[model samples]
Target chain A: MVFARARRPRALYLAYYFPPSRASGVYRARATANYLARRDWDVTVFACPMDFLDKVIGSKDEELLGTLDPRIRIERPPLNQYVWQRDARDFGPLRRTFPHTAQKGYAWTQRRLFPEHYASWSFASVRRALALHMRRRFDVVVATGNPFSSFAAAWLFRRITGVPYVLDYRDSWTLNQFTDELARPEGDPVHTWERRVTGGAAEVVFVNEAMRAWHAERHPHAADRMTVVPNAWDADLLDLPPLDLSVPAAPRPIRFTFLGTVTAVQPVEEMLSAFRMVRRHADFSDAELHIHGHLGFFKGADAALRGRLQSDADDGRDSGVRLCGPVPKTEVADVYRESDVLVFLTGGARYVTSGKIFEYMATGRPIVSVHGPGIAAEEVLDGYPLWFNANSLDPSALADTMISAAKAARDLSPEEHLSARRHADTYERDVVLAPFETRLRTLARRSS
Target chain B: MTLVDEAAKDTPGTEGTPPHVVILSYADPVPQRVLAYALYLLRRGVPVDLVTPTAPSSPTSATFPHFRVWEMKSVEERHPVKWLQYTVVHRLPSGVLNRVRRVARRVPGGGPVLRAERLARRTHRRVADLVDRRLFWPVYDHVRPLVLARASRRALASIDFDAVDRVVFTDTPAEHLAWKLAQRHPETVVDGRLDREPYAHLEQIR
Candidate 1:
């Protein structure tokens, strides 16, 4: 009897911000691709080209390129740099000849077609996927977005090739995560695309239960197909030290670290105010607030964010609020190890569950939340032994929480730290990705 | 104290010629802000040349040190069409009409007749203004970048392009001039950001 060898399921992953492009969403995209590849799936990722990462966004982490799974095939479809190009000398012939008309045409296309500056990338992504699909059929298409254009590309690929596609909401598109309202009004191009794309997707994945429920209520027909695959800390990337009771904790000048991209949406003003208030208190008088990450996603945003961090009264030295510039992923574990307490500063109240929270919890240090109450991340932090929630944005209230967190950092039992680490263990990248991988496998099998 | 005095105080002992920065600000409605940037470069020991569509209306009496203003309007007016529009169509006609009206004012029993003629001419001028704004200006503005780019070469003849280390663009209209400058002098750094400190870049080059 002759037996046929089983063919590995192929996944065409459309993630514009993938490994090497150190955008906040890139971690989740990287983890997903790596996990799928590890689980015996032939993963092919369509990501942003190098020029877009290196020149346009100007936030590339070369260290992250090495972290990607070797089995996964990566393709970077070219993007139209017309809108982002700053130098007039770099302008194309069409834009150079008729600048106003060209701008108007691009604006018109965005208004009518896909409604994103990265919309051209989506068309190119679809073309590349289709060409690849013709040579060797893909069993499934999985796409994540902020350039929610990737969802449109996945939907288009499904329409043309009849492949099952999953839409992963690493960040919300039509809904404003911060405001918890519709980002676009009714009948906007974004809303229209969201409807059509959600209607066609085989499965819709959200980072948190709040976001999942929000979309489920809006997309009732597709509710059954929706699932929550919470963002997890990369175990491969982060080497968190085990909680040790043998050595006594350091007593003075506790480090309160916030590890993530500093965006305008974050309650930075309140966080700073609380830190300043904490410094005034005798118990945490010498506490330092070290913000270790890129100041906004783009290079241009650094100066503005730096200005905000540096007040005239305090040039960061007197206040002990140090702006530690971005550290590579490999060096992140060192930042975590050196810090006594972690500051969970996020923007969105109900819907946002930051990936940094998982990494923060994994450190086994006391985690202080500096955001508004009822954040979806609180769902994960609920069982954490060392978790400290401010419960409000008022500086006084947040200051009190920071003091409590600092004390916890000094006095919390090794047992308590271990328990917190255990809570984080469930959110290790592979553990969180396992169920999602099974779902992808099932989808791929159904297509086969 | 004057900006020149401040520049002199800031850079007391510069050994050699500093980096020459040319600022192109054809569309900056406020020339004062461009002056501020020029002042910043001057204070940092860098010489600045400002190219604008028009001269600053309210410059201080105190002469600014290591600074020069090159008005492109002078070059733009040298264009045949613009020259005709300014000297012949608008200036000569209006001047001749005003002279004729002054002579008519001296004539006996010419008061009411002159008033009627003045009212008719005012109405005709209003129509002409409307035509210039509505019909002619859009096409003129569309072709203005190319014309300004051509004019910039002639306008900026005094400044040594080879010695110019930086070409700063204040706005979109200035981009045409920057683009032309970039083509001719590829080595000169062209940056749109005015907030940047020129000294930082100078340090990097050093």
Candidate 2:
């Protein structure tokens, strides 16, 4: 007898960066898409077109397209209207006369005309979401943000179709993490908009408990709806075995590899200073500080940021600090396998959590955390047997931590390494996102 | 090595080589189109080399050995105006002049000179902006090709213009360079982006 399984409820996901565009937020959106799809939720992803990502943001990783589950549906909305371009030749009449004035005009329009800055996808995204909802009646709507326009679109969908939406914060909106200030003044448009969106949302998802708690405290009325769903490492990417650290110490260079975007907030200059100190005193002269990531986010900003890193990489002449350049998502495993110690350099704080840390944890090698004290990173690296936390941002302290990490790399027992890897297995994408996925399934069913 | 690399190695870049093209791009990174076009040209027995400041971050496996990449001055070096443009693009605060003047006066024993310096900087920016708008921009546009061509001539010192059959530009900024190169070698067929797209158009599909 042939048996047919019941169809699961459908979820329409609104994400500004998805497959083809390797914006750091893409992974969170991908996780939501893949996790929901795997749990039999008929998922449709509203993603930014590849051309917009290629021409405007200038960083496109089409390889990410292959990583998506075939069961999912991806729709490209109209996002071409508000792409940022610095070329004066491409400017309008007002922009041509006063390029500086034109920039101010963009900021004004971003605040007054539409909430989405430089992202022209709001109208098109809303239009598409409405048409799709009318055609098939989406069970639940989900939107992830930092181009918080996706949330604005999701809110529009809720207003139109009454689809219970989940608001996921890949990064905080209206709350600046670096300065710990409100993104704007207390009662500005962004503040009002965020409050309205949160109050309307069925559930609000955050990357960490810190963010979730922050939002919960701010909007106590929607406290029950707020939940923390950490950005976990994709298990598929970690198919290769972690580098075995139990082998005999060799005089060869100990690769202290860091694989993530080298932004100012990550304390790259501080790390460089710490690295230079370690090289001098700790006899880590042999240790190669391999930085494998892009210099900046946009195409226009790349050269300026690269100029800073060029000095650190000693003008790409292969100093001890080497700028390895960015590697494809597929080649990430090979680089991990080659590294001896993983350097977790981040703006470590309660509000911040780098997904790279989970990927770092997956690699059983010793990790030296070169970031300020933060609960989110601390919680994740809690029981890591060979993890070294830098007590202070001081170069000397970080050097000592790096030395400790180096020592751990040389002297860890095979059992200790295996145990660390086993602990990371619990924090895999599937492991972390499963409960959140289940909650969404329940919400989708309830709405249907 | 991959098949593309193997093919590139096999292809002969002889002294008296067949007609070839050099695609010039000054500011922007290598777009996906250039990579595709280069590979297409290579496969069609046409030699193509990309002259740009930086290479594409994620090139296809096929692009490895197909075309040669010639580096140029970075955007920061080539386009110094843009460096200053981004820094002070936004409107200066209404009280900025007054605030600076006050700070200058408050500085221990160094008020007059600091205030004078601040006034000079403000005057310099205003004059520069006026000149940039009225004089430099309009004149620059008309003679852009000549300017870029002169710049390219210096940058491509090693390149043999005699052997190059075509000089192509995938974007607007480098079109002048293409035009300049085309003039020096009348025999060279220039596929200038200016002829096709005089102005940058939005990619908005109706």
Residue A141 displacement (Å), model 1: 1.5
Predicted structure with the largest TM-score when compared to the true one: 1
Any runs in candidate 2 off by more than 4 Å, and if so which? A1-5, A80-83, A87-109, A242-251, A281-283, A312-318, B1-206
lDDT of 2 by residue, A231-299 (tens): 888987667675554556566877899998877667777777887777875556767888888767765
Candidate 2, which CAPRI tier?
incorrect
lDDT of 1 by residue, A321-411 (tens): 8788889888999999889889999898899888899998888999999998998999999998898887999999999999999988888
Once superposed on the true structure, which residue ranges of model 1 sit more than 4 Å away at CA? A96-98, A185-187, A249-252, A281-283, A312-318, B1-19, B28-47, B56-67, B74-142, B199-206
Model 2 per-residue lDDT at A20: 81
- lDDT of residue B18 for candidate 2: 60
Please provide TM-scores, in order, for all candidate models, with all chains considered together. Answer: 0.85, 0.67
DockQ of 1: 0.16
